[model samples]
Target: MTEIGEVIELNRFDETSQVDDPDLARALARRKATFGASSVLFYDKPIHMASASGSWMQAADGTRYLDLYNNVPCIGHSHPAVAEAIGRQAAVLNTNTRYLVDIVHDYAERLLAEYPAGLDNVVLTCTGSESNDLALRMAEAFTGKRGVIVTDLAYHGNSASTTAISPGSRSDRSVPAHVRTVAPPEAFRSGDNDPGGSFAARVRGAIASLEAEGHGCAAIIVDTIFSSDGVYAGPPGLVDGAVAAVHEAGGLYIADEVQPGFARTGDAMWGFARHGAMPDMVTMGKPMGNGFPMSGVVSRPDVLTAFCEMHAGYFNTFGGNPLAAAAGLAVLDTIRSEGLLENARAAGKTMMEGLRAMQGSGSAIGDVRGAGCFLGVEISEPGSNRPDAAMARKVINGLKERGVLVGATGPHGNVLKIRPPLCFGEAEALVFFGAMEQVLAL
Candidate 1:
């Protein structure tokens, strides 16, 4: 199996290789020249140019592809409401968070209204990384501890502190002494029995390990869905044990909702709500502004106050700008007016049923799991559990060639990650299956 955080070249474009399409070749060369080795592009033959709308993206050559992998534009690409709100706000006023802004409060009130009681305050940030970084600080400040526990393949953010806790960020770097890793609560791995309790026991062990090493447990942070660990959404209350274990050890539970928030899970507005886990702090982003770069942390007032009292105070120049707030407000309005929650519920059910059926008929699909719009189909060697990274790559590229877009995740890079925009519907789901069938030779 591939190591966690190891670069899966199977799913990435090779820079030194070749390009047949002159237009695409020229574009790739130019990008390579400018971005150098830091550039990360998907597909072996990357498509050039793109404009997108609703649930589809058009290639530079004007070919349309069904979108099944983008989660950033939760309300759909180029949504008119969000675009208009952003345009209107930018044309009128876009300023720093230092000033009092009515629209900011309006957005905050609407956003916070969905959160559980005592998660009464919100601190806006420019990205999920910033939100997680701030959350780490808050947990330390509140608990006076220096340790964190996370799932083995978890990816919280890219900041230095978050990187230390994110095992999937890199296996090259040794985990910091204060941070410990545990397996995610995926049902299949646990034989469909007591996966939740197993995950909790792992957390408890990690907490003890941290304490034994002189760093008391400060927090247990998780995405709940475990998207990077191959989309492990589950039977209800899966996170209850882990949350209780952390709390028992005097550690906070920071729910990193960057992946599963804003009704992506269908059953609830936030992923943690599905399991009824109460987080001491919750961080969210990506879909907050339908791709407008708005992100934030929410916590009880006392928890927030604890951090502020220990420092010069937290602030971000562009975090809660009126423009971002307008975009966020538009997203909220769209989710409500479009009935995306109910759509996610219904559409997700259709997808789950379809994928499960696909699994029964094919050896390539080892497993099918996830909730709502976020799901994963594990690709495996025929008649065995061995991971088939090459097969996964083939399916991904094959689907792409047939005008569909998806992604790969899991340490083995063998699971097809199928998370589309919240605007995804039965029509979009049907398009995905049509492409999947052809790709799998079913």
Candidate 2:
């Protein structure tokens, strides 16, 4: 038998650092041996884990690292309140959606109340991919159209239909069709002095192209905060014009809020609110169940009714199970009771301002953009706006070495995505900012 230990060198982690586990690699090897290797693996480097609590994750080597990458842990990892709720529900009941359940109704009512009065229809799912797939279905059923328009690098979900609408699908070695992609408002890549203006122009061009192709589109799916495409929360009302164009072309507006919803933006419960636009369909996930596998789509009642009338039966095995509902309810309750949204607003202000201030002092810091807690710091070459993915990776990896865990975003992976749990405090931001400054200095 091949010795697994000789294939990799193990690194020791500090008490507050992430630990690596050989077991994870062994498991990966087992998968490779049986099911073949993953075609979409980003890197070979893997961080194995033991457990997570609050804002820290422990690895096999007993290292505890501060977490800044996990947007799903909105109430914070292993939050006692949410855990207790899940445990209670699991012990009592875990029924399917076919049975009448109060938890589902209560969760739907509470979640719906957050949106504008007319967008009240809701459908629960197990992942963001499912939510987006449902949104696509609604668009097709309501408009009897098969075409979709998506942002150039927008990431909706990994399901077949959602993948058809995602640019990441291509990078993941998947082919897509029947989708029109528009350039998002990116100041760095578009070479326009005004990213917002450039974005609008690109959108107009996409609409024109789609119209010419006889695929005018049933809907244009947009990530309200554009998380995967480098986190550009556009200038207020910038996307509104594009949305108007789509509407005029007889298409619905779909907002994929999987990464930026549920008060992650600080000012609003949903990222669409920040864009100053009302979406025809809004898909959400990640923070909805506080790390539990639950997501949903909120649509105009008429659109959902159309889907219902056309589809015969749309059933998901564990879409809105009792346990998932309990988790969702707990997440909402914790967000309200803890004032986490307010916390996100205050802490996010500190993070954005601090990053902007850092930009003034260092040429390595290119641009800082986003709203509330959904911010991204773009690393670039000195005296140029060009993305410096290498330096960005160094920064992120260095922070991880120093016991702080963050993530990289953008098409080139040069943007530092700072979406920690909504419960993250200003003090924690200061710590992260300080750590960032130190890493950059190094």
Highest-TM-score candidate: 1
Q: Model 2, stretches more than 4 Å misplaced?
A: 1-36, 39-45, 172-177, 188-194
What are the per-residue Cα lDDT tens digits for candidate 1 across 1-442?
Answer: 6554454465788777788788888889898899988888889888785799998999988989888888899989999999999999999899998888899999999999999898999999989999999999999999999899988778888899888887776856358889998888876544758889999989989998999999999999999888888888888899999999899999999999999999999998999998977999999989999889989999988888989999868989999999999999999999999999988888889998987777754568888888888988989877667778888889999999999999998878888998888889888888888888877884
Q: How many residue pairs clash in each candidate?
A: 0, 1
Candidates in order, TM-scores: namely 0.97, 0.90
Leading candidate by lDDT: 1
- Cα lDDT tens digits for candidate 2, 1-442: 1111211111112223332556766755564577653422222245667899877889776878788888989889999988999999999889789989898889889889889988988888899999999889889898877788877667788787877887654644233456777767776656666776666677777777767777666888888888877888867775787788778878899988888888988988888887766899998888888889998989898999999999985778899888899999998898899998898888788888888777754567888888777788888887787778778777877888777887777777778888888878767787788888898888
TM-score of 1: 0.97
Worst 10 residues of 2 by lDDT: 1-10
Model 1 residue 353 lDDT score: 91
Cα deviation of 425, candidate 1, in Å = 1.5
Predictions: Cα RMSD each? 1.4, 5.8
> Candidate 2 overall Cα lDDT vs. reference?
0.78
Error of 2 at 440 (Å): 0.9
State the lDDT at 181 in candidate 2: 76
